[model samples]
Target: MYICICNAVKESDIRDAVGAGVSCFKTLSKNLSLCTDCGSCGKKAKQAFHRALAESGASSNVVSIDAMSTAPVRRIQSTIKVSASATHHQKCIKTIL
Candidate 1:
């Protein structure tokens, strides 16, 4: 789907930008000229941009959740407690080492 017909920017392009660390509206405008001209697509573009970001986040979350649900969860071993007084500070003889 085309977000800005004037600039020939597509939804996929926006998604790609979002994936490449383009987070906010200003960065998006600089990258793709979104809402730069007549600004007719401003609202729609913002909506699509946010939607794309949300979808990407949701997809990643789903993948992680699925992996957690399917993978074998191991039981934790015995927990160890150390006394604060047991801590020792060793000085390196090599000054910087």
Candidate 2:
């Protein structure tokens, strides 16, 4: 779904950005020009950011995907492992919700 009409930003773009380690509104704004124009998409952007963070199994609310990509192999593996586990839990909760 489209999040920022002014910038042509979509929910998928936000998810990809989050997977790429954009964890904050500022970084999202800088990278995707999310809320820069009319600032109406800020709330949705934040929601998407948080949802992506939860899905990614990132411990920090302010993770940087660029940094994660550069991290050691073991760390990356662990992140993937955690993300898998979280995905299962999320599915269950989603079904319930």
Candidate 3:
């Protein structure tokens, strides 16, 4: 399913981004160039973002997708990496984001 027609961002890409710790639409837009043009895909992009978060088992309460959009990208990425590392239990996992 294509989430962003302007950027050609697919649902799977959004999910991968979520798995990599992207929790906000803004970060998604910055990283993937989604919803950056025309703004028609904002709603769909947000939906995809939330859906990805849910599927990834991440708590939406911890980081509001709407609020996190305004945060600095580096800060959000670092925080997400830290949290993911802390919660992930498996060994031999070398990378998360």
- Using TM-score as the measure, the top candidate is 3
Candidate 2: give its CA RMSD in angstroms. Answer: 12.2
The whole-model C-alpha lDDT of candidate 2 against the native structure comes to: 0.65
Q: Model 2, residue 19: what's the lDDT?
A: 81
lDDT of 1: 0.58
**Model 3 TM-score, 2 decimals:** 0.60
lDDT of 1 by residue, 4-95 (tens): 99999998998898788555555677789988898888878877777877877833311111223443322110111233311210111111
TM-score of each: 0.56, 0.58, 0.60
C-alpha lDDT score of every prediction, in listed order: 0.58, 0.65, 0.65
Q: What would the per-residue lDDT of candidate 2 be over residues 1-97, giving only the tens digit for each residue? A: 9989999999899889878865455557788987789999988887786787788876463323443356654453344335634454333333322
**Which residue runs of candidate 3 sit more than 4 Å off their true CA positions?**
65-97
Candidate 3, residue 36: Cα displacement in angstroms equals 0.9
Pitting candidate 1 against candidate 2, the one with the higher lDDT is 2
lDDT score, residue 49, model 1? 71
